[model samples]
Target chain A: MNEYKRISPSKRFLINIVLVIIFIVVGTLLTGGDSLSRASRALILQIGIYVILAVSLNIATGYLGQLPLGHAGFMAVGAYSAALFWKATLNMPTPVSIVLGLIIAGLIAAVFGIIIGIPALRLKGDYLAIITLGFGEIIRIAIINLSGITGGTPGLLNVPKYSSFLVVFLCVAATIAAIHFIMHSRHGRAILSIRENEIAADSCGVNLTYYKVLAFAMSAFFAGIAGALYAGFQGSLFPKSFDFMASINILVMVVLGGMGSMLGSVIAATVLTALPLVLQALAAYRMVIYSILLIIVMIFKPSGLLGRYDFSLPGLIEKWMNRKNKPGKEVANE
Target chain B: MVFLQQLINGLQLGSIYALIALGYSMVYGIILLLNFAHGDIIMVGGYIVLLIIAAGISPAVAIAACIIGCIVLACVIEKVAYTPLRSAPRISLLITAIGVSFFLENVAQLLWGADPRVFPATRIIPATSYQIGRLTISLTTIVTLVVAIAAMVVLMLLVQKSKMGKAMRAVSEDMGAAQLMGINLNRIITFTFAVGACLAAIGAILYCCKYPQVKPTTGYILGIKAFVAAVLGGIGSIPGAVLGGIAIGLAEVAVNALGYSTWTDAVVFVILIIVLLVKPTGFMGASMNEKV
Candidate 1:
């Protein structure tokens, strides 16, 4: 016990940082850079984008405990903004324009997130779901009707392909880090308190509106960045791709992996993104399978695979050390 | 004359919406589930009619089978998918409902290709038009309006005067109390799903008759709009669903008349949002505080 206390908080954080770096290096080495087939590379890149989407959605649906069914709308907004920015700034250096597009996409989507979140989040659970769903449909319809700007149903073309594996990897890492930081912070605790009990959270002086909107905006921001990456990767944009089905697909990832668990989102997103590609012959049956999985998961484990459990290497290490030193104390706490 | 024609058109569409909305309202009132699968039951009904007609069965027989098929499907869904999740979190139930909805849509797609099937209409419903003063309305529209109104009356009577209806009301009011009072909660819930499914089948037939094309996803959009109508009219109130349906139908027609057909869906959602914001309980729905 005495030695465990002597280790210090900063020392533990450094050890965690070192462990993370080692894991990343090992992961990169195992992935095999250029030896990976083109299809595999594409899949990896797609997984990164989906990781960002699933994690960001977890922030809203899992942590905040509010279901917003229109996540695709924000993504659509981000994609169009980024694609249009690239199109307009063709004269600029590719790297400079790409970064600018991402920032612009995220900021624009954040603005929309705040605008929609304010009124929509005021309503309770299912109402928020439908209203957000309505907003998603409206966004798609607007994209179709405003043909001149959105290029109509034919879809916008000639978006630059700046979404390389390195860029996507970096973005995914940044997204995970940012979300992890926010979720572990005091603000995250406040948001989580709201999820556990809104009335109690309110009585305790948590600013419901402010935190709700903030979480929503942050989720939208990352989704927007993911959308921008998608636009750059696909080199085109279609409103049809970002409909209600797409939203449900992301929701499935969050639910299947385990709500309120970031690692669960990452694992689910990666597995689901790869599942379709692996079973290309049975592509038609993919959605049916997804639906079945969703129902089964809900029926059997509604809390999800991870439930409320979050993986923490440091926490695990600390517990192990405590057990070695004084097992009775840890047992008593449990 | 054009205005009168649009009115007839709006009424035709509204009545169909009302028929579907009634199903939504009934189920929601009793079980508090949005019944996302309710709309897909309409799709199943259409496919049954399509297949039966293609196989040389009489239209009347096919219609009967369609109604029965919908009821069976709704019952099966409730028993298999929803029963176990009754005590789960509301969000979980909603997600499961969505899963059921997607499952139905995909199953339809796999069974009958994603392409819209050209519903053989001439043999199903007569295509004749009737002249009224300076305006002309099709026979199908008149038939649809009459059938919808008749069904509404029958349903209203059934709910107000019947024993099963009273049981439903009691269960909805207080499930525990109703059970203690000897009402079979499961049976009442099943009965509600059946009634809702039956109404959806009728609406499906009417909708197929008017639109004449059936796709795997045909029910998806209509289902959403009907749900909106149910909410608009007061989800648990029978008459309110009809009112909301007609209002939405007219609004859709008006938007089309104003030469912005593409905006109809968006406009409907905007209206839904506005209504929800102003009166979250909907037009005829009881106040939120009454549940306690």
Candidate 2:
């Protein structure tokens, strides 16, 4: 039928590669060539970090069907740890130290994730959300009290601004790809099954505890990565940034994007991140608008804009190939 | 002597917390929805009380108006934001509650600028203190303690004795069955919201009396902590909510006395975590098998 539906998988992959190359080229031109304002570049970087957080949250909330309200807590753990690592590794080269900082941040966040996930995942539904919220507050308070390490409420300053547009863009791409890979795997199906029916999944021999904890840990890992990126980009770390409202903002993204959809997360994250900047003229009404939008969206489309729909390049290609393989059947229907 | 004083203060604060926690527990029990907007209703009541007092009304009249305003506001919120989503996913309802909370907070900020306002000084309750040896008990604290206990007793009696309360209990036990038994589900739900808001109004006045200031964001923290109290006491249990509130109040006062005032919020959360871990159903909550 459609001309576009006749494309082969290999050709579709080539087209995607070309499109990505074009996107990178355009980004480089905008950020590096001084055509874009510094504020706009910063906004783009922030969007990149938000995309990572939203996608990670989607994994836990969308795929795993557990609403962990303490995502910001994980991000805080990652950010502070990464910044602390960078501070400690001052003697190392900047790039090497930054890379190491991200890894350590992610690992630390994962550890916290596991710690919280074990106790938290044992809970069902709303109880889990509240407990995670408590855990988030606990993390934030702990950060404030550990003044020696996190620099207390005054915040840790002088973090190197290592998160350039390119770095952030690359990180966002990698995070999305990694998450996509995970969700496309057999384990992902197990996680999704748990979301559909926990009892049914368990009866079918799906390891509920193992999968739930693993999904949570994975969500925390990427959240930490996003936090590390944010710390580097901002060159400052504040306990206030990773508070409950921060978690809510990230949750809003995941919910707005359609829980289990990666592309939806990216689009929602980008739009929401950029919306405030674009609406700077209405600065005071920003949060009012955000809250109102959240309410309206929940009322109008509880399943979100994308619902369970996802944009998969491979799936599209497969459909295209199948269509090509059945030309006569389509003709008969026409 | 100081320990005794702190204990008294804790009781006063705990009484207010218990009132708020009861509101939370009641709504949660009936609807199976955590009414996040319930706290914002207290903020609204405080503002209303402040406005009425600024107009030179009697304190009693101001409190009555505040209670009526809260009751109407809670009923309107349920009818508008919550009613449409009655059959939707529970998470959506929770999100809507959060939305309503945010909307009310922002509206408050817009209406009364975000600055903290001094609650108008009321001469209805004299600012006198009774000194006994090394302890001084303030009039407001005593009033709060008395009002809180009396209110709880009245509420218990109402639930245990009244037809309306019977309807509420039946609805909470099973909405489908209650409807089948010809109960007016909407009226019961609305009545529950009104009663919860009335208690919250009382809590708001007591809170303002002790703190003497009100801000748009004031209710957010108090609401969450009271929610912690509700969960601690066993969410659906009335006595449990009060017990949890007192325990939380005492714990906070003890931490404050220990000079770790900064860790007060963290301590509450820690208690919540411990409770959730040790007793998922809370102190008085019955085990409910989640029906798929």
Candidate 3:
């Protein structure tokens, strides 16, 4: 069992800690030792928000093996809910306001998740996708029509940007840690079983409907929390900001990282969030390049960049040289 | 009088929606892929029509030219975006189609900018309408309905009775089995997109007649509404798509009449969620038993 298992839990946990340390150090240097500069702070906040979005989506498209194009709709719910809450409770501190915002947004989205999942979960493949797409569009348009509260097309602005890096980072960490916990739990096993074979899983007594809805519910909940965090960070909100494009962005992030791989998602979100800024030379062509790359990735690496593997510095380096220098490969003719 | 006006508007709008939704339903009926970029291809067709008009051509000439142009572009998209991933999972194809949609929309924005432009509206659209008792109907309404219903019937006949229709149906049902029976799968897929795009071109012309304005982002919302219409009718059922479009059209009119235009998008979604809950297979969607 030890030989077959290949990697130990303690070592894996240690590897995560090491990576976290590395990321923190790099983030500090990139921010020039201060996280308050408008651009630097904004980048950090974006990473945190994307981490939230990408990881939550990993549950539906990644772990549950469902394609949901309506994640941004739920995010819009959270954004508006958080904005309303913050406005109503203007006297609260930043942290409490953010927490209340998270709870409110999460509850609202989870309710919606159940509504969307019930009918949609029954359909397989692209039918489910279309329903989700419809759901997303409806959310965007609804925001536009209800101009009285949502401010319609003009959007809500000057939201009082009170979010700091510490708040954002901590929220991101909790979000990631929660996802890790869920993945390692029994619920994760049920999700994977359903993804592998729904009929077979059902035959074995797995409640297919329950699990599918549960996945969507959890996804919506976290996405809501992320939206609340986003509202605080952006200090302004608009329905257009949480449009279909936003949902597609999250989907791309989830797909670009290996689906069903949590570590891959975190890494993908960070790199992609930083990518446009990092490669500023072709900013105008970002969508074009991104779209092309997305197609290329789907064609060549449908399993995504990591192919269901996690990043481990030591394990990777050890395996890296050993892999290439095999004296006599156990290669077989294809 | 207002009710009569709204009914006329609804029928005209509904017919255009029905036109595009038919293509969406037909393609989906055969292959479950949504081809999300189908609407953008319509947008592209409008641009093509506009270009031809600008090149010293009449509307009739431009319409014919643009129909051919739309077919070519749609076929090329299928070849470039979908052909390579045919054997991959269904979800991958859906995402690729989405990427294609983004590519086209961005390309339009790059070229046309974001400003809304009016299509050339002819004086033929009557300024007023004739009343029949309490109900009034306009020529535009009559023409659009006549054109849409006629097109749908012909398409139904072709799909159900024609020899090529048999080949298309055979391919849609099961590609491997169809290929084993000596059918060309690529030709069928290309033909499907071409036909779908051509219908979309007709829909574009009708939409331009009613709204008279087209912009890069015009397809975004209409695309969603038409998709809802497709799903509402029973995704793979052609008749279902037409019915769904009419229902959504009526519902949109009702929402406006009720003084709740603000809730139009919301109401449509609520309808979808409710429908999905009541009948997950959609109004006409069928359940195919998966081979374990």
Which clashing pairs does model 2 show? none
- For each candidate, the alpha-carbon lDDT, in order, equals 0.89, 0.88, 0.80
Clashing pairs in 1: none
lDDT (Cα, 0-100) at B272 in candidate 2: 90
Q: Write the per-residue lDDT of candidate 3 for residues A143-174, one digit (tens) a residue.
A: 88778888889887767565666666767777
Clashes of 3: 2
Ranked by DockQ from best down, the candidates are: 1, 2, 3
Candidate 2 lDDT over A65-115, as tens digits, reads 878889999999999988888888899998899889999999899999999
Q: Name the candidate, 2 or 3, with the larger TM-score value.
A: 2
Per-residue alpha-carbon lDDT of model 2 for B32-73, expressed as tens digits? 888989999999999999988888888889989999999999
RMSD of 1: 2.6
- Residue by residue across A10-65, what tens digits does model 1's lDDT show? 87778867876785675566455666777887888899999999999999999998
Q: Cα deviation in Å at residue A199, candidate 3?
A: 1.3
Q: How would the candidate models be sorted by TM-score, starting from the highest?
A: 1, 2, 3
Cα deviation of B88, candidate 1, in Å: 1.1
